[model samples]
Target: MSIRPADSTSNPPPGSTSEATSEATSEATSEATSEATSEATSEATSEVSSEVSSEVSSEVSSEVSSEVSSEVSSEVSSEVSSNPTPNLDIREWIRIGTLEEIDKNGPMVVKGIVVFQHEGSLYAVENRCPHMGFPLHLGSVCDGVLTCHWHHARFDVCSGGTLDPWADDVPAHAIAVQNGIVYANPRPKQPKNLDWHLHRLREGLEQNLSLIIAKSVVALVNAGVAPARIAEVGIDFGTSERSAGWGPGLTILAANLNVIAKLDTYGQILALVQGLVHVARDSAGRPKRHMLQPLPATEFGTPRLQEWYRRSVEVRDIDGAERVLLTVLGGDASDADVADMMIVAVTDHFYLDGGHTLDFHNKAFEALAAIRPELRPQVLSSLIPGLGNPTRSEELQNWQTPVDLVSPLFAAFRELENQLGRISPATLASGTSDSPTDRNASSIDGSASSIEGSASIMPSQTSPLLTDRQTRTDAEKIVDVLLGDDPGVIVETLTALLTSGVDPVHLSGLVALAAAKRIVHFHTQNDFGDWIAVLHTFTNAHAVHERLKQSQNPLATRAIYHVAMRIYRDRFLNIPSAALPKSDAADRAGYSTDLRQLLALTDKQQQVAEAATWVAHYIDTGQPMGPLWNTLGHLLLREDAEFHSFQMLEAAIKEHEDWEKSTRSIAKDAMRTLVLAATRYLAAHAPTARELPQVARIAWRLARGEKLFAE
Candidate 1:
């Protein structure tokens, strides 16, 4: 009787009838049995004399026959039966077809193995292409090369070595030819080890190899390596290898840690891929840094460890610094303690490399939190090279500042910290118990005062002295005054507008626009220090206006005034704003389309001016600002990665006001400022232009009634 392996399907081989299938199946069983018995007898006789060998041969023959008979019977029955059950054991060599049958079919797929005949030789490989998981059985084979139909990734049929770098290497299996039948080992070869994959990931980053980067990421993720660890390697390599020190790549990685973590497995991989590509591109052809060895582990308290870490970082001892950090993190140190230490270390020097060092430090901590605690040491180790080798010395202005702005800024931040206490900005505004003031009492008093004030300046009761048209005209004058030499006049105008029952929110919006103008017009050669401050003030004013929509807080007016005053003081440095055509008021759809179009412009100055004007126009037309905001929010989320971007985004999100109830003028001005800030960010960061289409799609979707914010 011929034996057929289990998992052999009932389907006839290509170009073979049912009769031929039965004949082949029976022949396989008989051949298997004969081969087994013949081998058993030969082994029995070779080991003993003829007289004793006869008895041994009988026993061996019977045993081999019984076992082979059972296997053959079961396999043949399954193959011949109408319903053939698949074999669960993938390691078993299943009979797919004869060599001639494989040749007739071109390639035969059996139990995930692709068995094909080339030049009278049988070859079997995993059915899936290594490049994109495309089916290889459908691919064409010529001159011993198998070419994937989709991406045209070519591979050697016999060796499974890929001709294309993007395809990597496909897993090929051993093929057994017995009795003219082709049997394939269905179990694919095991993938590369974690260390090997990690090495490839590093190579990808070093050489800016995208396909290798993608393959390594997938392999690592599939191997159960933590996403955080994978992300850390990319972050570390990008930051350390780049000659320019920290950059938008590191900032982008830091900014999107939370977003990346929340994405599905594939999305997370793609996010890392994009981030690593930026790092690689930024660092390509730059001097490569060698990894440092850690000092011997020693017992130290948190304070001592922190001191050691700081000292190590100060001396550019990458290994020592990371070991110290890892030690602290490995211990019972609280997250706050670790954060405090990191903050101190980063701030020890002012404007560390155009503020990138501080930004990277903050983002590192943020990214660190997303990782598993056990894996943090690995992540910290990866970041140490960048930390120790910052491009700080290259920033000569930071070192040779004529004025000591650093100390004053630090002092101001310290004062704010003291005032704020332990409560974060988010909790402070939301009336949490952690807030310094009594939430209920403050809300009641604030609301009552606001109600009383609004009654006096109510839209229904106010005179037509400052009509909507006049308010817009006055808002424009405020902008003109802001650009003028007289600071006192600008302040007076801002105060007058607020007191004259011109909507405070609207007035604040104008102040924000002026603040943003200060940023746009800023032409000083100062390092990243004061220029960033201008951006913060504008975003802050925008945040204040959003808060004012909910409650008429006196503090909101004060914040707006301060921002306006700052803009006025910086007027001497103001360059003329770009001469862009004014946009006409349009419907939400039209405006959304316009925003997308503006974002595509290669000229940053033009993009910023046009976007700001368009937003102002939409607001002036009294269209709902929520959808526009939603669109802006999406763009920020996708591209903005700088510390300032985070601050602006945070401020935009903190305003828990009903957008629909916001005064049109205030909403317009506030949005204009916010959009201008976003445009400035895009100008600086220069995120991939390919993302524009996706951004446009999101904006269009919102216009078509999709939720602005996904739950």
Candidate 2:
């Protein structure tokens, strides 16, 4: 039988000739036709010459036809023998003729696959390299190993295992041969889905493998997992894995959920991967804890639900508490309803772990609000771990002691909460609506040096000239006075300065600085957390100063003085003051160098003292304090500072602005005190040293008199 041409539209059957064989058949057919015509013409002439010629012609025609047919069959068979199993499927066995046909072609691509003949066996695999999708048909096979020519990624053709880790394993087909033909199933052995990917994600987190975490995140996201859900896994894993309760990693993870939503698919995956890495690293080798599981849904009114949630959290039944909250969330609860419930729960326990618990809960709701409503469930659910983690102050300390202050503090918090809407802005600040002209007109211009004019606010004495040396000496003396047993001495010294035409603003700073120093140096048995209040009071004075700058308000200054006195009263915790470092008068450039070097020092406590001494010297030498304030601003922004640190930094920045606008000695002194307080606070907090280069650049600019925050 004559071989037919291979059809391009349909898969070629086993043992079919190639396109080259078909072309050869066509040429042989044309030659055969010409030979038959010539023989017919010669036979007709012989027929006229003799009677036997007719029979001879008939025989010649039969012989010629047989010869042409045989030659065509032989050529077609030869070509067919060169290639075997041109189109083969693993699902069925293929008959591709004899082994000689496979040997002739060595290796051939069949149905977009490469089929190899090795040592009397046939193997088939995907033609594309797994590394970069390069075709494996161009690759060489030797000793059963297939090597991609492009990148030399070698794979065992028999097993489809990659030799290089960078190149993934090539997908091998299930091959079967019957009657010398080969077939293959192109489908992969095992198919992966969303569940599999999520499982891998958990595994990755458990093992702290970054690569697996990254792959799992991308896979889950591509498979349609919500970003919030991905974040939930990280939060849950982080909180549950660590024995020391929740840490900054979980907080950072939740905070970035809003940010992750705005990024592209890859960027989102990357951000989540980074967050997961942090959580895993932070929790690695830590003791594991049982995570709180959400309870069954229930129908309850908002008020009843809030009460139940608060009681559950108060009793430390966090699982039950979270279940109630989640149940409410599952229903028609509004964001406000949720926030109110959370706020009640958080506020139920005052000063929970230095107030970080409350701050985290507030931030959690804020972060939740930033996301779309649909994405809030998983994100909200993730917060259960943190909610259950706080160690309340009441649990740790005896509330019966006078110094415990827990009951009174909680009572104060409740009172403040109750009075929130009842107080008006005018009642709060006394003169918030004062116009620019009113404010500028009220600005003191050294015209009120006499004590009688401002007697109620300032003492009846001529304020001492706050020269650089005198200011330092007074600050040292104030610290000395504060360290003494008598609180009256501290108040009297501060009042005398206020009466000395010393701006109360400056006096506030000096008092705040002393309060800060007391806290820093106080090496007492009682680790009084009340120092936070003292620091906040000192920081708030800057606000009082700013308000009174635009419009004269003696009440603001008096309020600040009372707060300062409270700080003094608290200073008797028996903590001795840290010795203040003596300063050498350095020029502006030299001072800048000192500040920059101080920031780079690993000893943060010493850095604080150095920063304070440098700023004091700058003030004493009559150099502009704005650059020093600007330098601090740059330092504060260097890292992702804690919330409280930012609060102090922002207050300092505002104080700096107020000082820049006014050349009053009080502004200068207050500025100096605020700077010292800030440096000390920062020293305690010790912001991450990741921004040292930026700090250096900022210091250089400030030294040259260039504006830092010009806009």
Q: Taking the tens digit of each residue's C-alpha lDDT, what string does model 1 give over 262-376?
A: 3555545555665666677777887765444444566667877877776666567766776677778777778767665554454343334444454455455556655555545
Count of clashing pairs, candidate 2: 9
Steric clash pairs (candidate 2): 89-184, 90-183, 90-184, 90-185, 439-550, 463-500, 463-501, 468-620, 522-575
- The residue ranges of model 2 lying beyond 4 angstroms of the native Cα positions read 1-206, 209-246, 252-277, 285-297, 369-375, 386-389, 395-404, 407-589, 593-605, 612-711
Expressed as tens digits, the lDDT of each residue in 218-258 for candidate 2 is 55665567888787677656655676445656555554464
Per-residue error for 636 in candidate 1, Å, reads 8.4
User: Would you give me the overall lDDT of model 2?
Assistant: 0.49
Taking every candidate in turn, the Cα RMSD to the unseen true structure, in Å, is 16.0, 20.7
